[model samples]
Target: MSNRSTRARIGRRVMVHTPVGGSRSVMMGAVAAVTLATLVTGCGGKSQDHPSSSAAGNPAIGKLPQATTFANLKNVAKDSGADAAGNGTVAHPTAAVPVSATPGGPPVATLPDKELGGPTWVPVVETKPGWQRVLLPSRPNGATGWIPAGKMHTAHSPYVVKVDTSARRLSLLKSGQSLGTWTVAVGAPKTPTPAGRTFIMASLAPAKATYSPLILPVGAHSESLDTFGGGPGTVAFHGWPQKSVFGQAVTHGCIRVPADALQQLAKVPLGTPVSISN
Candidate 1:
Protein backbone atom coordinates (compact mmCIF):
# COMPACT_ATOMS: atom_id res chain seq x y z
CA MET A 1 0.00 0.00 0.00
CA SER A 2 0.97 3.67 -0.18
CA ASN A 3 3.02 5.26 2.60
CA ARG A 4 0.02 6.92 4.29
CA SER A 5 -1.83 3.58 4.33
CA THR A 6 1.17 1.81 5.76
CA ARG A 7 1.56 4.33 8.60
CA ALA A 8 -2.09 3.97 9.65
CA ARG A 9 -1.47 0.24 10.11
CA ILE A 10 1.55 1.04 12.25
CA GLY A 11 -0.49 3.42 14.45
CA ARG A 12 -3.06 0.68 15.00
CA ARG A 13 -0.28 -1.73 15.98
CA VAL A 14 1.05 0.78 18.56
CA MET A 15 -2.38 1.23 20.18
CA VAL A 16 -2.73 -2.58 20.39
CA HIS A 17 0.56 -2.76 22.40
CA THR A 18 -1.01 -0.85 25.34
CA PRO A 19 -0.96 -2.82 28.63
CA VAL A 20 -3.49 -3.22 31.51
CA GLY A 21 -5.33 -0.50 33.58
CA GLY A 22 -2.20 0.53 35.57
CA SER A 23 -0.45 1.74 32.41
CA ARG A 24 -3.74 2.83 30.76
CA SER A 25 -3.19 6.61 31.27
CA VAL A 26 0.38 6.57 30.00
CA MET A 27 -0.50 4.33 27.03
CA MET A 28 -3.53 6.47 26.20
CA GLY A 29 -1.33 9.60 26.05
CA ALA A 30 1.18 7.79 23.81
CA VAL A 31 -1.59 6.54 21.50
CA ALA A 32 -2.99 10.07 21.18
CA ALA A 33 0.48 11.38 20.23
CA VAL A 34 0.93 8.63 17.63
CA THR A 35 -2.55 9.28 16.18
CA LEU A 36 -1.80 12.97 15.70
CA ALA A 37 1.43 12.05 13.92
CA THR A 38 -0.45 9.64 11.67
CA LEU A 39 -2.98 12.33 10.70
CA VAL A 40 -0.20 14.68 9.64
CA THR A 41 1.49 11.93 7.68
CA GLY A 42 -1.78 10.97 5.97
CA CYS A 43 -2.17 14.55 4.85
CA GLY A 44 1.22 14.22 3.11
CA GLY A 45 3.45 16.08 5.52
CA LYS A 46 6.58 14.06 6.30
CA SER A 47 6.06 10.82 4.31
CA GLN A 48 7.74 10.90 0.90
CA ASP A 49 5.65 7.91 -0.31
CA HIS A 50 2.29 9.64 0.13
CA PRO A 51 0.35 10.43 -3.08
CA SER A 52 0.03 14.13 -2.30
CA SER A 53 -1.00 16.67 -4.87
CA SER A 54 2.51 17.95 -5.34
CA ALA A 55 3.61 14.39 -5.98
CA ALA A 56 0.75 13.79 -8.44
CA GLY A 57 1.80 16.76 -10.58
CA ASN A 58 -0.55 19.32 -12.10
CA PRO A 59 -2.27 17.40 -14.95
CA ALA A 60 -5.24 19.58 -15.89
CA ILE A 61 -3.91 21.44 -18.92
CA GLY A 62 -4.87 21.91 -22.58
CA LYS A 63 -5.38 24.47 -25.36
CA LEU A 64 -8.35 26.89 -25.47
CA PRO A 65 -11.08 25.75 -27.84
CA GLN A 66 -11.85 27.64 -31.05
CA ALA A 67 -14.73 30.07 -30.68
CA THR A 68 -17.85 29.83 -32.92
CA THR A 69 -18.00 33.34 -34.33
CA PHE A 70 -15.97 36.52 -34.30
CA ALA A 71 -19.19 38.40 -33.43
CA ASN A 72 -20.11 37.11 -29.92
CA LEU A 73 -17.28 34.58 -29.44
CA LYS A 74 -19.15 31.65 -27.86
CA ASN A 75 -18.83 27.86 -27.67
CA VAL A 76 -20.99 26.10 -30.26
CA ALA A 77 -21.08 22.95 -32.37
CA LYS A 78 -18.33 22.89 -34.99
CA ASP A 79 -18.53 21.69 -38.60
CA SER A 80 -17.00 18.53 -40.14
CA GLY A 81 -13.80 18.00 -42.22
CA ALA A 82 -10.00 18.03 -41.78
CA ASP A 83 -10.43 21.07 -39.51
CA ALA A 84 -12.97 19.27 -37.38
CA ALA A 85 -12.91 19.53 -33.59
CA GLY A 86 -9.99 17.39 -32.34
CA ASN A 87 -8.74 17.78 -35.89
CA GLY A 88 -6.94 21.03 -35.12
CA THR A 89 -3.41 20.35 -33.94
CA VAL A 90 -0.71 21.72 -31.65
CA ALA A 91 2.55 22.81 -33.23
CA HIS A 92 5.42 25.23 -33.09
CA PRO A 93 3.35 27.28 -35.57
CA THR A 94 4.11 25.00 -38.55
CA ALA A 95 5.85 21.63 -38.38
CA ALA A 96 3.07 19.94 -36.39
CA VAL A 97 2.85 16.44 -34.89
CA PRO A 98 -0.38 15.44 -33.13
CA VAL A 99 -0.67 14.68 -29.39
CA SER A 100 -3.46 13.86 -26.85
CA ALA A 101 -4.09 14.40 -23.12
CA THR A 102 -3.84 11.79 -20.33
CA PRO A 103 -7.15 9.90 -20.45
CA GLY A 104 -9.61 9.55 -17.50
CA GLY A 105 -8.44 12.70 -15.76
CA PRO A 106 -10.49 15.74 -14.70
CA PRO A 107 -11.89 18.04 -17.34
CA VAL A 108 -10.28 21.40 -17.97
CA ALA A 109 -10.84 23.85 -15.12
CA THR A 110 -11.77 27.50 -15.62
CA LEU A 111 -8.95 29.78 -16.72
CA PRO A 112 -8.64 33.51 -17.56
CA ASP A 113 -9.16 35.25 -20.88
CA LYS A 114 -6.36 36.93 -22.77
CA GLU A 115 -6.15 39.25 -25.77
CA LEU A 116 -5.84 37.44 -29.13
CA GLY A 117 -2.71 38.18 -31.17
CA GLY A 118 -1.84 37.15 -34.73
CA PRO A 119 -2.86 37.59 -38.41
CA THR A 120 0.75 38.82 -38.62
CA TRP A 121 2.89 36.24 -36.85
CA VAL A 122 3.50 33.48 -39.40
CA PRO A 123 5.84 30.54 -39.05
CA VAL A 124 5.71 27.03 -40.49
CA VAL A 125 7.07 25.59 -37.23
CA GLU A 126 7.38 26.93 -33.69
CA THR A 127 10.94 27.47 -32.52
CA LYS A 128 9.92 26.61 -28.99
CA PRO A 129 7.54 23.65 -28.71
CA GLY A 130 4.32 24.12 -26.69
CA TRP A 131 0.54 24.42 -27.17
CA GLN A 132 -1.50 27.51 -26.20
CA ARG A 133 -5.13 28.13 -26.99
CA VAL A 134 -5.59 31.45 -28.74
CA LEU A 135 -8.21 32.45 -26.11
CA LEU A 136 -8.07 30.17 -23.04
CA PRO A 137 -5.50 30.63 -20.32
CA SER A 138 -3.26 27.72 -19.28
CA ARG A 139 -3.07 28.52 -15.60
CA PRO A 140 -5.28 29.73 -12.71
CA ASN A 141 -4.71 33.52 -12.81
CA GLY A 142 -1.59 34.19 -14.86
CA ALA A 143 -2.60 31.10 -16.79
CA THR A 144 -6.27 32.00 -17.14
CA GLY A 145 -5.86 34.22 -20.20
CA TRP A 146 -5.14 31.28 -22.57
CA ILE A 147 -4.54 27.65 -21.77
CA PRO A 148 -1.20 26.32 -23.03
CA ALA A 149 0.43 22.94 -22.47
CA GLY A 150 3.63 21.13 -23.44
CA LYS A 151 2.11 17.69 -24.05
CA MET A 152 -0.10 18.71 -27.00
CA HIS A 153 1.25 19.04 -30.54
CA THR A 154 -0.15 20.30 -33.88
CA ALA A 155 -2.75 17.60 -34.66
CA HIS A 156 -5.45 18.04 -31.97
CA SER A 157 -5.60 21.64 -30.81
CA PRO A 158 -7.51 24.31 -32.77
CA TYR A 159 -7.26 26.47 -35.88
CA VAL A 160 -8.35 30.11 -36.03
CA VAL A 161 -7.63 31.08 -39.66
CA LYS A 162 -7.56 29.64 -43.21
CA VAL A 163 -7.71 30.91 -46.86
CA ASP A 164 -7.94 29.30 -50.32
CA THR A 165 -7.93 31.48 -53.42
CA SER A 166 -8.62 29.57 -56.65
CA ALA A 167 -6.33 31.33 -59.12
CA ARG A 168 -4.29 28.56 -60.75
CA ARG A 169 -4.16 26.58 -57.45
CA LEU A 170 -5.29 26.78 -53.82
CA SER A 171 -3.34 26.91 -50.53
CA LEU A 172 -4.83 25.47 -47.35
CA LEU A 173 -3.07 25.91 -44.02
CA LYS A 174 -4.55 25.09 -40.60
CA SER A 175 -3.20 26.46 -37.34
CA GLY A 176 0.11 26.20 -39.18
CA GLN A 177 0.00 22.78 -40.85
CA SER A 178 -0.64 22.67 -44.60
CA LEU A 179 -3.09 20.44 -46.48
CA GLY A 180 -1.05 20.86 -49.65
CA THR A 181 -1.63 23.30 -52.57
CA TRP A 182 -4.79 24.36 -54.47
CA THR A 183 -5.42 26.71 -57.46
CA VAL A 184 -7.36 29.95 -56.72
CA ALA A 185 -8.79 33.17 -58.26
CA VAL A 186 -7.66 36.75 -57.82
CA GLY A 187 -9.31 40.15 -58.45
CA ALA A 188 -8.75 41.60 -61.92
CA PRO A 189 -6.76 44.79 -62.55
CA LYS A 190 -10.10 46.67 -62.62
CA THR A 191 -10.79 45.32 -59.12
CA PRO A 192 -7.89 46.60 -56.98
CA THR A 193 -7.50 43.62 -54.60
CA PRO A 194 -7.89 42.65 -50.94
CA ALA A 195 -4.84 40.79 -49.76
CA GLY A 196 -3.59 40.63 -46.20
CA ARG A 197 -3.69 38.40 -43.13
CA THR A 198 -7.40 37.97 -42.25
CA PHE A 199 -9.27 35.73 -39.82
CA ILE A 200 -12.68 34.01 -39.98
CA MET A 201 -14.70 37.08 -38.89
CA ALA A 202 -17.95 35.16 -39.66
CA SER A 203 -19.49 32.42 -41.82
CA LEU A 204 -22.95 31.24 -43.07
CA ALA A 205 -23.88 28.06 -45.00
CA PRO A 206 -27.36 29.03 -46.18
CA ALA A 207 -30.22 26.58 -45.69
CA LYS A 208 -30.65 26.94 -49.47
CA ALA A 209 -28.22 27.33 -52.40
CA THR A 210 -27.70 31.05 -51.72
CA TYR A 211 -25.06 32.67 -53.94
CA SER A 212 -23.75 36.21 -54.66
CA PRO A 213 -22.47 36.49 -58.27
CA LEU A 214 -22.76 40.05 -59.65
CA ILE A 215 -20.27 42.10 -57.60
CA LEU A 216 -18.08 38.97 -57.23
CA PRO A 217 -18.02 38.23 -61.01
CA VAL A 218 -15.36 35.69 -62.14
CA GLY A 219 -14.62 34.79 -58.52
CA ALA A 220 -15.63 32.13 -55.99
CA HIS A 221 -19.26 31.95 -54.82
CA SER A 222 -20.34 34.08 -51.84
CA GLU A 223 -19.90 32.84 -48.28
CA SER A 224 -21.27 35.86 -46.31
CA LEU A 225 -18.81 37.35 -43.91
CA ASP A 226 -18.30 40.08 -41.29
CA THR A 227 -15.84 41.60 -43.76
CA PHE A 228 -15.11 45.36 -43.51
CA GLY A 229 -18.46 46.79 -42.30
CA GLY A 230 -19.54 43.36 -43.66
CA GLY A 231 -18.89 44.58 -47.20
CA PRO A 232 -16.18 45.70 -49.68
CA GLY A 233 -13.17 43.53 -48.79
CA THR A 234 -15.65 40.95 -47.53
CA VAL A 235 -13.05 38.19 -47.86
CA ALA A 236 -14.57 34.76 -48.58
CA PHE A 237 -12.80 31.76 -50.26
CA HIS A 238 -15.36 29.59 -51.98
CA GLY A 239 -16.42 27.64 -55.10
CA TRP A 240 -16.90 28.83 -58.70
CA PRO A 241 -19.87 30.91 -59.92
CA GLN A 242 -21.47 28.49 -62.47
CA LYS A 243 -21.48 30.98 -65.39
CA SER A 244 -18.51 32.94 -64.02
CA VAL A 245 -14.87 32.65 -65.14
CA PHE A 246 -13.49 31.45 -61.79
CA GLY A 247 -9.88 31.03 -62.96
CA GLN A 248 -9.74 34.78 -63.68
CA ALA A 249 -9.40 37.80 -61.34
CA VAL A 250 -12.90 39.37 -61.20
CA THR A 251 -13.42 40.26 -57.54
CA HIS A 252 -14.05 43.77 -56.16
CA GLY A 253 -10.96 43.04 -53.99
CA CYS A 254 -11.76 39.90 -51.96
CA ILE A 255 -9.03 37.31 -52.57
CA ARG A 256 -10.80 34.57 -54.55
CA VAL A 257 -9.20 31.51 -52.97
CA PRO A 258 -11.48 29.27 -55.10
CA ALA A 259 -14.79 27.70 -53.95
CA ASP A 260 -14.32 23.94 -53.28
CA ALA A 261 -11.86 25.14 -50.70
CA LEU A 262 -14.73 26.71 -48.74
CA GLN A 263 -15.71 23.42 -46.99
CA GLN A 264 -12.21 23.18 -45.53
CA LEU A 265 -11.90 26.89 -44.77
CA ALA A 266 -15.36 27.02 -43.17
CA LYS A 267 -14.14 24.69 -40.43
CA VAL A 268 -12.38 27.55 -38.65
CA PRO A 269 -14.31 29.93 -36.37
CA LEU A 270 -14.18 33.72 -36.31
CA GLY A 271 -10.76 35.00 -35.20
CA THR A 272 -9.09 32.00 -36.86
CA PRO A 273 -6.00 33.08 -38.81
CA VAL A 274 -5.80 34.04 -42.52
CA SER A 275 -3.01 35.48 -44.69
CA ILE A 276 -3.77 37.32 -47.96
CA SER A 277 -1.19 38.69 -50.38
CA ASN A 278 -0.62 38.83 -54.17
Candidate 2:
Protein backbone atom coordinates (compact mmCIF):
# COMPACT_ATOMS: atom_id res chain seq x y z
CA MET A 1 0.00 0.00 0.00
CA SER A 2 1.14 3.53 -0.72
CA ASN A 3 1.57 6.10 2.04
CA ARG A 4 0.48 9.72 1.90
CA SER A 5 3.95 10.73 0.74
CA THR A 6 4.16 8.08 -1.95
CA ARG A 7 4.75 9.79 -5.26
CA ALA A 8 4.10 8.16 -8.64
CA ARG A 9 3.40 9.28 -12.15
CA ILE A 10 0.22 8.17 -13.95
CA GLY A 11 -0.41 8.67 -17.63
CA ARG A 12 -3.50 10.15 -19.18
CA ARG A 13 -6.43 7.69 -19.41
CA VAL A 14 -4.91 5.64 -16.61
CA MET A 15 -7.37 4.74 -13.88
CA VAL A 16 -6.19 6.46 -10.70
CA HIS A 17 -6.42 4.25 -7.64
CA THR A 18 -5.15 5.14 -4.18
CA PRO A 19 -2.82 2.74 -2.42
CA VAL A 20 -4.95 2.99 0.64
CA GLY A 21 -8.71 2.66 0.32
CA GLY A 22 -10.69 5.86 0.91
CA SER A 23 -7.72 8.07 0.04
CA ARG A 24 -7.11 9.11 -3.57
CA SER A 25 -4.08 10.85 -5.14
CA VAL A 26 -4.00 12.63 -8.51
CA MET A 27 -1.21 14.22 -10.51
CA MET A 28 -1.50 17.09 -12.93
CA GLY A 29 0.82 18.53 -15.57
CA ALA A 30 1.17 17.99 -19.32
CA VAL A 31 1.33 14.25 -18.65
CA ALA A 32 -1.15 14.20 -15.79
CA ALA A 33 1.06 12.02 -13.58
CA VAL A 34 -0.32 11.68 -10.01
CA THR A 35 1.22 11.13 -6.69
CA LEU A 36 -0.80 9.16 -3.91
CA ALA A 37 -2.71 5.96 -4.50
CA THR A 38 -6.49 5.40 -4.58
CA LEU A 39 -8.76 4.69 -1.62
CA VAL A 40 -8.84 1.12 -0.26
CA THR A 41 -11.27 -1.03 1.74
CA GLY A 42 -10.89 1.00 4.90
CA CYS A 43 -10.24 4.67 5.33
CA GLY A 44 -6.59 3.62 5.53
CA GLY A 45 -4.80 0.70 4.01
CA LYS A 46 -4.87 -2.69 5.67
CA SER A 47 -4.15 -2.40 9.37
CA GLN A 48 -1.00 -4.03 10.69
CA ASP A 49 -2.06 -4.24 14.32
CA HIS A 50 -5.00 -5.96 15.94
CA PRO A 51 -6.78 -5.02 19.10
CA SER A 52 -5.91 -7.04 22.17
CA SER A 53 -8.70 -9.47 22.94
CA SER A 54 -8.03 -9.04 26.63
CA ALA A 55 -9.51 -5.57 26.33
CA ALA A 56 -12.80 -6.82 24.93
CA GLY A 57 -16.01 -5.65 26.61
CA ASN A 58 -19.66 -5.86 25.78
CA PRO A 59 -21.01 -3.03 23.65
CA ALA A 60 -24.60 -3.63 24.88
CA ILE A 61 -23.45 -2.54 28.34
CA GLY A 62 -21.74 0.60 26.99
CA LYS A 63 -18.31 -0.99 27.35
CA LEU A 64 -16.03 -1.70 24.37
CA PRO A 65 -12.73 -3.43 23.91
CA GLN A 66 -9.80 -1.96 21.99
CA ALA A 67 -10.84 -1.66 18.30
CA THR A 68 -8.86 -2.83 15.33
CA THR A 69 -9.23 -4.41 11.09
CA PHE A 70 -10.60 -3.59 7.76
CA ALA A 71 -10.70 -7.15 6.43
CA ASN A 72 -12.16 -9.25 9.22
CA LEU A 73 -15.65 -7.82 9.50
CA LYS A 74 -18.25 -8.60 6.85
CA ASN A 75 -22.02 -9.06 6.46
CA VAL A 76 -22.65 -5.58 7.82
CA ALA A 77 -26.12 -4.35 6.81
CA LYS A 78 -26.55 -1.54 4.34
CA ASP A 79 -27.59 1.88 5.63
CA SER A 80 -31.13 2.66 4.42
CA GLY A 81 -31.71 6.04 6.02
CA ALA A 82 -32.38 9.14 3.99
CA ASP A 83 -30.02 12.09 3.87
CA ALA A 84 -29.71 13.70 7.26
CA ALA A 85 -30.70 17.31 7.16
CA GLY A 86 -28.72 19.17 9.83
CA ASN A 87 -28.42 16.53 12.47
CA GLY A 88 -25.92 14.23 10.81
CA THR A 89 -23.30 13.16 13.33
CA VAL A 90 -19.69 12.10 12.83
CA ALA A 91 -17.63 10.11 15.31
CA HIS A 92 -13.95 10.55 16.06
CA PRO A 93 -12.34 7.74 17.93
CA THR A 94 -10.08 8.69 20.83
CA ALA A 95 -8.44 5.31 20.51
CA ALA A 96 -8.89 2.09 18.58
CA VAL A 97 -12.44 0.96 19.40
CA PRO A 98 -13.71 -2.54 18.92
CA VAL A 99 -16.56 -3.15 16.42
CA SER A 100 -19.06 -5.86 17.11
CA ALA A 101 -21.49 -7.85 15.03
CA THR A 102 -24.13 -7.38 17.72
CA PRO A 103 -24.56 -5.28 20.80
CA GLY A 104 -23.12 -7.84 23.18
CA GLY A 105 -21.37 -10.05 20.65
CA PRO A 106 -17.63 -10.57 20.32
CA PRO A 107 -15.81 -7.86 18.45
CA VAL A 108 -15.00 -8.41 14.79
CA ALA A 109 -12.55 -5.55 14.26
CA THR A 110 -11.21 -2.32 15.69
CA LEU A 111 -11.70 1.23 14.39
CA PRO A 112 -8.47 3.08 13.78
CA ASP A 113 -7.62 6.58 14.88
CA LYS A 114 -6.58 7.92 11.49
CA GLU A 115 -7.12 7.43 7.78
CA LEU A 116 -5.09 8.81 4.88
CA GLY A 117 -2.87 10.56 7.43
CA GLY A 118 -5.89 12.47 8.69
CA PRO A 119 -8.05 11.83 11.73
CA THR A 120 -10.56 9.05 11.12
CA TRP A 121 -14.13 10.32 11.06
CA VAL A 122 -17.00 7.92 10.40
CA PRO A 123 -20.67 8.76 9.89
CA VAL A 124 -23.16 7.47 12.42
CA VAL A 125 -26.16 5.88 10.70
CA GLU A 126 -28.20 4.41 13.58
CA THR A 127 -28.13 4.68 17.32
CA LYS A 128 -29.08 2.24 20.02
CA PRO A 129 -28.87 2.84 23.74
CA GLY A 130 -25.17 1.99 24.04
CA TRP A 131 -24.11 1.30 20.43
CA GLN A 132 -23.94 3.39 17.31
CA ARG A 133 -24.10 1.89 13.82
CA VAL A 134 -21.55 3.48 11.53
CA LEU A 135 -20.86 3.17 7.82
CA LEU A 136 -17.61 1.31 7.23
CA PRO A 137 -15.21 1.85 4.34
CA SER A 138 -14.75 -1.83 3.74
CA ARG A 139 -15.89 -3.81 0.70
CA PRO A 140 -19.29 -5.39 0.01
CA ASN A 141 -20.61 -1.89 -0.39
CA GLY A 142 -22.92 -0.45 2.23
CA ALA A 143 -21.13 -2.37 4.96
CA THR A 144 -21.83 -1.16 8.49
CA GLY A 145 -20.61 -2.03 11.99
CA TRP A 146 -21.61 -1.41 15.55
CA ILE A 147 -19.36 0.56 17.90
CA PRO A 148 -19.78 1.80 21.42
CA ALA A 149 -21.07 5.33 21.23
CA GLY A 150 -19.61 6.27 24.58
CA LYS A 151 -16.07 5.42 23.54
CA MET A 152 -15.74 8.14 20.93
CA HIS A 153 -16.37 11.84 20.45
CA THR A 154 -19.18 12.98 18.20
CA ALA A 155 -19.98 16.09 16.19
CA HIS A 156 -22.69 17.21 13.77
CA SER A 157 -21.93 17.91 10.10
CA PRO A 158 -24.48 19.97 8.22
CA TYR A 159 -23.02 19.15 4.81
CA VAL A 160 -24.52 16.44 2.63
CA VAL A 161 -23.40 15.41 -0.87
CA LYS A 162 -26.02 14.06 -3.25
CA VAL A 163 -25.07 12.47 -6.56
CA ASP A 164 -27.44 11.67 -9.41
CA THR A 165 -25.72 9.27 -11.73
CA SER A 166 -28.52 9.20 -14.26
CA ALA A 167 -28.38 12.95 -14.57
CA ARG A 168 -24.61 13.02 -14.21
CA ARG A 169 -24.80 15.73 -11.60
CA LEU A 170 -23.46 16.36 -8.08
CA SER A 171 -25.20 18.53 -5.54
CA LEU A 172 -23.92 19.92 -2.26
CA LEU A 173 -26.21 20.81 0.59
CA LYS A 174 -25.62 22.53 3.91
CA SER A 175 -28.24 22.58 6.63
CA GLY A 176 -30.85 21.40 4.13
CA GLN A 177 -30.07 24.31 1.82
CA SER A 178 -28.74 23.77 -1.67
CA LEU A 179 -25.22 25.09 -1.95
CA GLY A 180 -24.94 24.34 -5.70
CA THR A 181 -25.03 21.61 -8.28
CA TRP A 182 -22.66 20.77 -11.13
CA THR A 183 -22.35 18.29 -13.95
CA VAL A 184 -19.75 15.57 -13.28
CA ALA A 185 -18.48 12.34 -14.73
CA VAL A 186 -19.63 9.02 -13.39
CA GLY A 187 -18.51 5.40 -13.72
CA ALA A 188 -18.54 3.69 -17.08
CA PRO A 189 -21.17 1.12 -17.92
CA LYS A 190 -18.78 -1.77 -17.34
CA THR A 191 -17.66 -0.42 -13.98
CA PRO A 192 -20.63 1.30 -12.45
CA THR A 193 -20.25 3.32 -9.27
CA PRO A 194 -22.00 1.61 -6.36
CA ALA A 195 -24.80 3.79 -5.02
CA GLY A 196 -25.57 4.08 -1.31
CA ARG A 197 -24.72 6.12 1.78
CA THR A 198 -21.05 6.85 2.45
CA PHE A 199 -18.88 9.55 3.95
CA ILE A 200 -15.87 11.62 3.00
CA MET A 201 -13.15 9.41 4.34
CA ALA A 202 -10.10 11.51 3.47
CA SER A 203 -8.84 14.62 1.78
CA LEU A 204 -5.50 14.38 -0.03
CA ALA A 205 -3.19 16.73 -1.91
CA PRO A 206 -0.88 15.21 -4.46
CA ALA A 207 2.72 16.33 -4.94
CA LYS A 208 2.31 17.45 -8.55
CA ALA A 209 -1.12 19.04 -8.33
CA THR A 210 -1.71 18.61 -12.04
CA TYR A 211 -4.82 16.54 -12.50
CA SER A 212 -6.43 18.09 -9.46
CA PRO A 213 -5.39 20.33 -6.61
CA LEU A 214 -6.89 17.93 -4.12
CA ILE A 215 -8.44 14.48 -4.06
CA LEU A 216 -11.45 13.93 -1.81
CA PRO A 217 -11.84 10.19 -1.19
CA VAL A 218 -15.24 8.93 -0.10
CA GLY A 219 -15.98 5.82 1.91
CA ALA A 220 -17.27 3.93 -1.16
CA HIS A 221 -15.64 1.41 -3.51
CA SER A 222 -16.26 0.17 -7.02
CA GLU A 223 -18.77 -2.63 -7.48
CA SER A 224 -17.10 -4.20 -10.52
CA LEU A 225 -13.40 -3.83 -9.98
CA ASP A 226 -12.10 -5.51 -6.88
CA THR A 227 -8.82 -3.65 -7.24
CA PHE A 228 -7.23 -1.11 -9.52
CA GLY A 229 -3.81 0.49 -9.78
CA GLY A 230 -2.70 -1.85 -7.01
CA GLY A 231 -5.27 -0.44 -4.61
CA PRO A 232 -8.72 -1.54 -3.59
CA GLY A 233 -11.31 -0.33 -6.10
CA THR A 234 -12.18 2.60 -3.83
CA VAL A 235 -14.21 5.33 -5.50
CA ALA A 236 -13.40 9.01 -5.02
CA PHE A 237 -14.44 12.55 -5.97
CA HIS A 238 -11.73 14.49 -7.83
CA GLY A 239 -11.24 17.14 -10.50
CA TRP A 240 -10.38 16.40 -14.07
CA PRO A 241 -8.25 18.76 -16.10
CA GLN A 242 -10.35 18.11 -19.19
CA LYS A 243 -13.58 20.02 -18.95
CA SER A 244 -15.05 17.73 -21.54
CA VAL A 245 -15.06 14.77 -19.16
CA PHE A 246 -17.69 16.33 -16.99
CA GLY A 247 -21.25 15.05 -17.55
CA GLN A 248 -19.94 11.92 -19.14
CA ALA A 249 -19.86 8.41 -17.72
CA VAL A 250 -16.27 7.66 -18.61
CA THR A 251 -14.34 6.93 -15.44
CA HIS A 252 -13.52 3.53 -13.99
CA GLY A 253 -15.48 4.13 -10.78
CA CYS A 254 -14.37 7.56 -9.56
CA ILE A 255 -16.45 10.70 -9.86
CA ARG A 256 -14.68 13.28 -12.04
CA VAL A 257 -15.92 16.70 -11.06
CA PRO A 258 -15.45 20.16 -12.51
CA ALA A 259 -12.93 22.55 -10.99
CA ASP A 260 -15.64 24.62 -9.36
CA ALA A 261 -17.35 21.60 -7.87
CA LEU A 262 -14.05 20.33 -6.49
CA GLN A 263 -13.42 23.70 -4.90
CA GLN A 264 -16.78 23.64 -3.14
CA LEU A 265 -16.36 20.05 -2.03
CA ALA A 266 -12.93 20.76 -0.61
CA LYS A 267 -14.50 22.82 2.11
CA VAL A 268 -16.76 19.99 3.22
CA PRO A 269 -15.26 18.10 6.16
CA LEU A 270 -14.49 14.43 6.22
CA GLY A 271 -17.29 12.17 7.51
CA THR A 272 -19.88 14.31 5.77
CA PRO A 273 -22.58 12.02 4.42
CA VAL A 274 -22.67 11.33 0.64
CA SER A 275 -25.74 9.88 -0.97
CA ILE A 276 -25.39 8.41 -4.46
CA SER A 277 -28.57 7.45 -6.29
CA ASN A 278 -29.12 5.96 -9.70
Residues 145-255, candidate 1, lDDT per residue (tens digit)? Answer: 122354222334355333333344456665557765655555445443443333343343323332322111111112221122111122344444442445656543454
In order, what lDDT does every prediction score? Answer: 0.31, 0.67
What tens-digit string does per-residue lDDT give for candidate 2 at 1-278? 12211212233222444322123333343132222223322222332222233333544322332221123235456666554422589998766677777776666666766665677788888888999988776665776778987988999888999999989999999988999999998987877877888888888886656467787878887776544443455688988767887888877778888888898999998889999888
Question: Which residue segments of model 1 deviate by more than 4 Å?
Answer: 1-168, 212-233, 257-259
Task: For model 2, state the Cα shift of residue 240 in Å.
Answer: 0.4
Among the numbered candidates, top TM-score falls to: 2
Residue 3, candidate 2: alpha-carbon lDDT: 21
User: RMSD in angstroms, all models?
Assistant: 27.0, 8.1
